[model samples]
Target: MTTPDAPRHSRPISFAIFLAIAGAVGWWAAFNLTVSKIEVLENPSVDLACDFSVLVQCGTNLTAWQGAVFGFPNPLLGMGGFVAPIAVGVGLLAGARFARWFWIAFNVGIVGAFAFVIWLISQSLYSLGTLCPWCMVVWVATIPLFWVVTTRNLVEGVLGSSLVGFGAALRSWVVPITIVSYAVVVLLAQLQLNALARL
Candidate 1:
């Protein structure tokens, strides 16, 4: 039931805060990765700060072909892409109301990022046989960012009205779902790379 007093897509302060925090964390990770990559380029002999060990380090992933999938360092993408969420969150907190089109575009971008993260996770665990700390930080932020934004859009009928109820149901389970998503990554890493023993 639509009412004048209550809009379908009301501002969510908590979601806004979440977005801000996640965006900041993601951006920080991307910045660190970019720095590491540049440092490697400047001096190949230098050991990176994030290189905790052979199995847990950023050097292997940074030098790999996967890190430059777009012919540029992947961290560049993160450095730029993460800014959008921060802006959107700050805008919402400032009482800005966005159009449905804006939300749709944002969601689409998030879906792309999510898909990319999944691919990176696969490449990291199965192919690279290593865990990059900065990359994992990006993953942690992206996972929940995707889930929360998508679910919020669904609840607000930005995706469609028909899915509102389903979105509402999912809203309460976002945290658990995020935890399970993280667990899946951990389990895969452990099974494939013996991440626990290596650490």
Candidate 2:
């Protein structure tokens, strides 16, 4: 049985740093999307600042039904959702640790975000036939953020059973796994969307 006096596995400072980095990127993406949305509302035909080319276009995605899945722009969700991580990161940096339930809730949010981004990536590749730069930025940050946070959760035993030795093993491989996943997505985009050629 775990003893109450036993030292808990506290999150490292680097975790907070990475979280802050991800939050900043997410915030930037959300802010720009909000701007693009406003522009669209102001002038239905207004050319978005992020509308770079036919391939890398936010206008197309913004106009898509998938853009406003909840009857509001998706970025609005980001604007609010990303605040939690930022706050949490700041708290961690200040030496505050959360309860098991809090970590579980945070992980759940990241999992949901990861799933949504995956769907967005698929739509951008197959259905939309377009990629938004801002959305892509969110995807980039979300991937690593989810990776690190999920791995941390497993290692810290926040989810049900404590992983024990498995957590350390997973942590060691997390970066490589995240990198491979990112490469696969980029490669797929290059093959299907000609992302490299567009660049």
Candidate 3:
């Protein structure tokens, strides 16, 4: 499951870099999805560019009951929320270290994001019977962002000074863990949707 080591000459891929990349990608996807949602809102019958296939389309999800869970397009939250990680990552790269309270707050937001994405995943897999590609991008970005930040906090002694072995393992096992997690999702999607056959 381990892929490869990061470039040696380059600075090691820190949690901050992961945060920045994930945030940027997630924000971009959310922005696109939001625009697609608007397009659908203007004309529900119109086809979206992201509507690639019946099972891999965003249009179905955009109109789903869970899509507007808070009475507005969910991407609005992503658009706003993703900026924080990018900012924090930039700050870190610029040599800014955050206080414990800030880390705590940031982690709380990440946990919320993780929970919300899980709900969307279940909804997409079980209820909607379709996929939102951009949303999937967000989900892919969000999961590792959550784990990387959390494990970094643990490894860096940001959260606590205990469980050194556990922290080390989490940090070392990132690639494999992500591979396994992604495999599980892919397997579940294939199982529930028979995703490839429908294509």
- The reply for model 1, stretches above 4 Å from the true place, is 1-10
Which is the leading candidate under TM-score?
1
Kindly indicate the candidate among 2 and 3 with the higher TM-score: 2
Highest lDDT: give the candidate number.
1
In the range 1-199, model 1's lDDT, one tens digit per residue, is 7689875766789988999999999999999999999999999878999999989999999999999999999999999999999999999998899999999999999999999999999999999999999999999999999999999999999999999999999999999999999999999999999999989
Whole-model lDDT values for every prediction: 0.96, 0.88, 0.86
Give the TM-score of each candidate. 0.95, 0.91, 0.90
Badly placed stretches (over 4 Å) of model 3 are 1-13
Per-residue lDDT tens digits for candidate 2, residues 133-159, read 999998988898888898888877887
Per-residue lDDT tens digits for candidate 3, residues 39-135, read 9989988989999888999998888879889999899999999998999988777767778889878988998999999999989999998878999
Model 2's TM-score against the true structure = 0.91
Candidate 1 has an lDDT of: 0.96
